[model samples]
Target: MSVTTKTDGAGDSALVFEQRIQDLCHDELFEQGTGSEVAYDLISNELLLDGSARLNLATFVTTWMPPPAGALMAKTADKNM
Candidate 1:
């Protein structure tokens, strides 16, 4: 495979988006690794069908809260995990 690079609008090399070996990812990992951008885009697209947590009333865990508490939790997420 060949990769050619050009500067993007942000002046960063656009070669990563030129990935040519990508395949659909599902229960198994791709035999050829897709670049991070493609992987993230696919995963996020898959998650688009999922319902928003705040709209799920049956969940036992807290879903709706003030912004400050959510921010605090987000800040300390690594420690909490």
Candidate 2:
């Protein structure tokens, strides 16, 4: 998922906030780990202030998974043989 920010119209503050979120998502500790639940909880509790607003961070993490096309096919082939 790509997050686009309108830097010119929103001003520097918005740009910085967006950048921080992007950085957090791309952090090494988060990248090489399976902590979607943890990440989701953290974001929901800390960043999402509005009680009515709901965000699903798990969906974001799943976007980064390796495609199952060829991998699953190969596994099935092995099982059949």
Candidate 3:
């Protein structure tokens, strides 16, 4: 998603949050694996423990990203069979 924010404007908080979340998703923790419920649960717990902002970030990613990624991976695996 595209996020735009002015440096000294009111939306700065949202912009920062989005940037932080984007960074988190690109971190090593998320890079190690995908599609494992154990991994998802662990990540979810970690974010939820981090307070509301991080929790929201985790929720956003989980809701928006995982399903499509899972579907694509499944399709690829099926094609390879």
Candidate 4:
């Protein structure tokens, strides 16, 4: 699969997944950049396996926040540290 990177209005980069591809292919051995690609694939798949964040409540804190709110919280957390 061809890897496509997306940029938001704010110029933040993100990955665009056309299909579910494992970051690491068990059949093939790892080579330099391939290993990292495999890892990214795995992480992306796991986070997106479920339909939506609201539907999944498996975490300790299932409270969902909008992206802006989450970003603000992340900044606040960083300041406290």
Candidate 5:
């Protein structure tokens, strides 16, 4: 599957999503794992479909948000689990 992105319109840069994924998959860190092209494509496609991980509010701990954002999220935080 081929993925393309516009450079001038959105915040995306010249490098398309597929190229970026290829670059990331080629990185030494990820290459050391047993993951293959099929896995990469599946994961990357899912991420693209899911939009930005930073925008996902369900998994708040891993996201990078503003300092005040913590206070807002504090009430819903899972302290027991």
Candidate 6:
């Protein structure tokens, strides 16, 4: 039986099921580009597998931040240190 993991998006090509096609290259750098949308989609889908962030009840202070700080973070997300 063929087992499939990915539910939607991506297209007919398989990432989890297919052993031949490499979803990502490990050692070697890509000689060609797959465009911004394709690269973003691949990363975004990978992050989805990690699930949403959850606050620990015992360390609520560490996880919960003021709305102002959160807004600031969101606004400055693109900035480099």
Encode model 3's per-residue lDDT on 38-76: one tens digit a residue: 445447767666556434444355545567787985687
Stretches off by above 4 angstroms in model 3 are 1-35, 53-81
TM-score, predicted candidate 1 vs. hidden true structure: 0.33
* lDDT (Cα, 0-100) at 1 in candidate 5: 50
lDDT of 6 by residue, 1-81 (tens): 659553434543343334453568768888755555556666777877753435333334557789998898679645512
Better of 2 and 5 by TM-score: 5
The CA lDDT of each predicted structure is 0.57, 0.46, 0.49, 0.52, 0.51, 0.57
Candidate 2 off by > 4 Å: 1-31, 50-81
Q: What is the lDDT for 62 in model 3?
A: 51
Query: What value of lDDT does candidate 3 attain over all alpha carbons?
Result: 0.49
| Tens digits of per-residue lDDT for model 5, 1-81 | 559632333322323444544434543464234334445555666668655546665666555778787777686555412
Clashes of each: 0, 0, 0, 2, 0, 0
TM-scores vs. true structure, each candidate:
0.33, 0.21, 0.22, 0.23, 0.24, 0.36
The reply for model 4, stretches above 4 Å from the true place, is: 1-34, 54-81
What are the per-residue Cα lDDT tens digits for candidate 2 across 1-81? Answer: 659633333233333335444435543454343244545555666644542212534324544446675577467754433
- For model 1, residues 1-81, the per-residue Cα lDDT tens digits are 559553222412244345553456458764545456655666676677566655655445776889998898789755543
Candidate 5 clashes between residue pairs 3 or more apart in a chain or in different chains: none
| Root-mean-square deviation of Cα positions for candidate 5 versus the true structure, in angstroms | 14.1
lDDT of 4 by residue, 1-81 (tens): 759744232311123245544444658665534334545555677758645635644333737879997787678753433
Candidate 5: stretches off by over 4 Å = 1-35, 53-70, 74-81
Instruction: Name the best candidate (by TM-score).
Output: 6
Off by over 4 Å in 1: 1-25, 53-81
TM-score of 5: 0.24
